[model samples]
Target: MDVIKKKHWWQSDQLKWSVIGLLGLLVGYLVVLMYVQGEYLFAIMTLILSSAGLYIFANRKTYAWRYVYPGLAGMGLFVLFPLVCTIAIAFTNYSSTNQLTFERAQQVLMDRSYQAGKTYNFGLYPTGDEWQLALTDGEMGKHYLSDAFSFGGEQKLQLKETDALPGGERANLRIITQNRLALNQITAVLPDESKVIMSSLRQFSGTRPLYTLADDGLLTNNQSGVKYRQITIAVIISRSTPTEAGVMKNSVLVIPLLSARKTLRASLPTKGSRSLFSLSSSGPWSFRSSLWC
Candidate 1:
């Protein structure tokens, strides 16, 4: 008697190798994409899926694994990993008190500074390839010039009685829309230790530092001579006040307000809440959890 032979899905070694090769290529593409975008976590998940698929197709003993590879890969890439990440993020403390990582916190605190320096009105002079910043200090009676490459230093401006305009005293600003030399804003320090900020095409001024951040984490305001520090505790308070300075008592923080104003503004409340304007004199306020007190 002759025995009958049945062909299985992975019976062809060529087809199995083809499938494995294709999965490997897909995983390689995903790895490159994720790495470029800084998504290292997702790249690892893709690598795991590729390994499982390659093992199932390349090994004859694991031929039966072909039937479940698609479902396994789908779950690992889409469902399981995302659900795990969501749960992990829920447990981590990322409120206001712990808003940034250690590195980012240090950078932010170091960059916290205010200007209280000399003021100089500026004019923009676009010269085809580059732009020129012309600064004038009326009180000091000086004129300075700077460009993209080098500071042109002080340039003599022959002032005449006719140069002075009437009441409006427009600052010789001529906007040539074709050149488009203006920037939205530029906050940078000059060689003279003065900060220059260009708010708009017509408005640019020089400033000096009025506040400095101390190593002890205090913000010293040079103008008012006030030292301010960040709030490190967790305090729950009424949302009536939105100022920076507030009183702290035990675990509760009392925000000081010179006066309280309540306006009847209409709003739609969430489910199981009172009408938007139904609150009494002790008005209702909205708040969310934060790291700051």
Candidate 2:
């Protein structure tokens, strides 16, 4: 009498289920890549090659070591290589300064805007994707009436008189104006690839995107008849005035610069009063100083 025969590994239902599950995952991944990246051809080719390799390995009679080498090599290159690269970057000063790929950093720094006479305060109204100024103030309670203008839209309302004061604690509100002028409690929203100017109380219309990104970097404002181009490493003010404007006029500005060196000297204000300036070479840099009265 013959002993009970054992079934081959390929005949096992568990093995079949595992293979089917793997194939489903592969198909799902391919579908996502195709929809998100629009790289259907590449995804299809990769899926076909991987599935063929998997099927060959599963059905092969001889456990050839060469068959495993290809899959192992691919895993090392795609999975392990990126992890190693990320760890390496974490040690270097690769932040907003150098961390941005050459093109991205240049774009970010170049997009910065500064105005000389415009005073921007909080409180704005949003009509669809456009924006309108709802309130303006300078010298604490000294309020000014200004009309709402739609940013990135063609609607401009005349400044009507209003006597509304923002009910809240009084603070310097320096950083808020510098980065973004939040409207009421809503976060400031910049149009895609466009930057807005925070104004001072001088009633100066701030600079805006005159040239679209499609125009290279030439900016022109037909309303003011101003035209300018992107300058290399230059602090060109978007809005300029003949006289000193703000409270911090002619004060020392310790502007931070991006550097690749491990240790970097802090920046000192070349023209303004002594103020604390900070920077992070590898990440997003911070610059802070007391508002000079």
Candidate 3:
């Protein structure tokens, strides 16, 4: 009598190799993508985890661990990580002050520059095969020229205001569109250290930072000279659940974050400095964590 044999998923060596190769390529692509997005820490972590996972899945000796790893990774990434972050953030102002984090606020301030003084007009001038940038404050002002820059290809723009711009053969619509993205990244510094950036396709202007952050958690308004000092506020969490007799009021932590009044009008809660945790005023129960000055 002939006996029947069982067929397994990895019975074919070619299939196993193909799967492994595909997974390696996918992991490499994801790692490179994360790196390009400036998520260096996450990229490293992903690389390490992917290497270990591949090793465990491919090796017979660690076959048991292969089954365990997926669950553990899922629990770590999906459950534990979010739980930990949420718990940690509950003690602080994670979503306070118009839900703006410190880093995000800094980026907003950094990008809040405005054109000041005389603005310059920008256009591309031909330089052999490539193109050099030309900037002029007026028709007769000292024309600032930039070195020939290449974008939409291997090389990128590193334009300098020290470089001169002159009227000649201008770049066509095709070339301008090709280099438009790279042009946006270009910021040229003048001899006086003032920055000039392209505001539009044919417009270049002087730009100045509106705010700056200091080492000691101080945010300074460069235009108004207002300094915002970081301070801590106590979070009083009251569990309104009726236990055996009364509700439990648990005080978590003293959170330190943004608590400032800007000149611009916004739809945000009124700024308060009441952070002593000693609530002398009568108010309703609030779950919103405080980051008062």
Give lDDT for model 1: 0.49
lDDT of 1 by residue, 136-229 (tens): 6678776665544322333323222222222222234454232233332344445555556653454446443554667766555566565545
Deviation in Å, model 2, residue 91 alpha carbon: 2.9
On the 0 to 100 scale, the lDDT of residue 86 in model 1 is 76
Those runs of model 1 whose alpha carbons end farther than 4 Å from true positions after fitting are: 1-104, 112-121, 126-132, 135-202, 206-211, 221-293
For each candidate in turn, the TM-score is 0.31, 0.30, 0.39
Clashes of each: 6, 15, 6
lDDT of 2 by residue, 1-293 (tens): 98987999888979887977788697767766553443433455466556655555565563584567588657755887567657756764445554444356446544554443334454544444444454353654544333434333233234443576434333334633542433212322222222223344223334543333336664444445554433233322232222443422221111223322322233333534323332222233333233322
Clashes of 3: 6
Tell me the lDDT of model 1 at 143: 62
The candidate that achieves the highest TM-score relative to the unseen native structure: 3
lDDT against the true structure, per candidate, is 0.49, 0.44, 0.59
Residue runs of model 2 more than 4 Å from their true location after superposition: 1-67, 93-108, 115-119, 124-132, 138-140, 147-293
Clash pairs (backbone) in predicted model 3: 134-165, 144-164, 144-165, 145-163, 145-164, 145-165
